[model samples]
Target: MATITSAAPAATSDDRFFMRMAIVIAFTIVAGFALNFAMGRSTIAARPLVHVHGLVFMGWVILFLTQVRLATGGSLAQHRRLGRIAAGWVCVLVVMGLAITVDVTMRGGTPFFFLPQHFLIANPMTMLCFVALTTAAIRMRRRSDWHKRLNLCATISIIGPGVGRLLPLPLMVPYSFDIVIFVSLLFPAAGMIHDWRQSGQVHRAWVWGALAIFLIVPTSQIIARSPVGDMIYAAVTQGHPGEKVPGLEFPPSPMPE
Candidate 1:
């Protein structure tokens, strides 16, 4: 299987910069399937929430790539200006994330490929991690080293849904969600090794950020099947959507044409 990795021993600045770009570009390509869905390729219609979610996610991709280009070109003034805008936009992303998670679960858009409660829990956890890491990155903006690494950590956090969609992650596998999570780890794993190789130590930003991103997996598995999970599932998904969509079993969806 092919793999993604960060800089090797004594890699140049250009190498590190392009590695970061590759990470985001890879995510964008994986998630590009959403465009198909939007164009009527998928049965799921593009409702308001779905449209907003797509816009927000796509906006972040553009902002991330553009910011990387700006920083690499020494356009610090322009980058900071856009960074401020991106920071505010990050808040929108988080709010929309939470809203869509609840909305999807409530409406039974939680895929047949996932345990409903776990889906709800894991989906929002990514945003929580994103908000924390991105906020930390912004606070440490003057410390360019920490800022850059943490920003990488934060941007990669949202790659989970993309990875899950691209991979053939059916609900049948006993560890399907785990598989999605493990594939997603390639992002931070690359960053972790990059940090270690470059500085002879893993940056604490990557350490903490990777912890935040990775921990949600086991935590969801643990929490979503517990009493807490029952209450959460019971509360958010009610009546029709809840009954129509079983929490643990796969439901029929439109087969591809």
Candidate 2:
């Protein structure tokens, strides 16, 4: 009988890469909270929607870290199994994100750093895009290259919120969308670099995915100004009768002396 040949050992260098990525993620979260505290942003006061959004987002961060740990531990089978749960969790996150975005915008209590007009329009769109990209990534899981790139794209698309907190709001306010564009570009750039190093050619999926996300800012802005956005804003705001639409006015402190 012919001798059977064993496959060569796969590269296991993802440990260092994942550890570095985890550090960056942890730093972003810490810096986000620190900046919010320093700026006295009112998100900490915690409306119901805000609480739910926070919990969902924090859970995502935890889940991401856990996934990285499991993958690095060579628990590929377990990681794939847990990914189903993570996929469900992502849907919940998107729902809570939309709920919070609508709740804050309608109440006219949008985050202080963001332009209320832009925030009202852009936030929900961001969440929707995130869900779409994440779902696409899940769908392509059997294709490792596609799965990795799409997941990176999804993560990069959502990094704006955390990056925004790191920026000085006063400086960023006039160029909020520009900041988002710049930060959002990093994912594709990273992908290009990875491709150049690994395969000597940039992946078309990363190129297209990044471009799509880049276009969304202007698209969302136009949509926000359109009658459709106005009508949706009106409908949600109408739920609270007699209170002025908050986006039309400056935010008020919810606490009283």
Candidate 3:
């Protein structure tokens, strides 16, 4: 009698895809924490609200890492179980994010190394975009492809803070406003690269989203300096104790032409 042979079960493609995603997520988390540490040290004397924002943002990073780990480790049921908690956590994150933006602007705490006039507008717009993308991602959670893409977009949206911190602020001061566009574009670039490597095609939505974010920086600056934005800023700051208006200055008594 001939001996019977047993074949090993082959791993599914989903397993390989999940493994790759896990690696990328892990790398991003490590990079984020390192950047945070470096920037936090430089801004050690920053206001309490800055620290609060950092803590909340770091909590989000931790949660993201945990979720990725859980999903990749064959804990889908437990991951779904924690989805509700994550949703509530995201709400708190949005609240803290908005509160930090308001407090920073009101207290004249926008990073001084950059052009405050543009930074003020860009920062808040970033927060708003982050919230919008994140909410949309959550809404499409049941649709795996849509959910994944939206979640990646949301991740890119929030990355400005991390990227801004990691960049050499002093070196970029001359083109501070433009740096926002550069940083925002990086996320979509990363996504495009990932998609190209994984599926041999770049997703159209991500391409569009990246382009939108790149445009938003300049557009937001234009709007912020416009009459309407000026009026809104003035109204919002009217009741605040120590608000400051940001603008460029010209020296008095110019040399004769």
Instruction: State the C-alpha lDDT per candidate.
Output: 0.74, 0.69, 0.62
Candidate 2 local Cα displacement, residue 124, angstroms: 1.4
Q: Among these predicted structures, which one has the highest lDDT?
A: 1
Using TM-score as the measure, the top candidate is 1
Tens digit per residue, CA lDDT, model 1, 79-103:
9999989999999989988998899
Model 2 Cα lDDT, one tens digit per residue, 33-83: 667778787456766667777778888877777776676665889889989
Q: Where is model 1 more than 4 Å wrong at Cα?
A: 1-45, 252-257
lDDT of 2 at 202: 83
Q: Which tens-of-lDDT digit does each residue in 164-201 have in candidate 3? A: 55566555655655774576576668767766876688
Residue pair clashes in candidate 2? 108-246
Over 4 Å off, model 2: 1-19, 42-45, 239-257
TM-score against truth, every candidate: 0.83, 0.82, 0.75
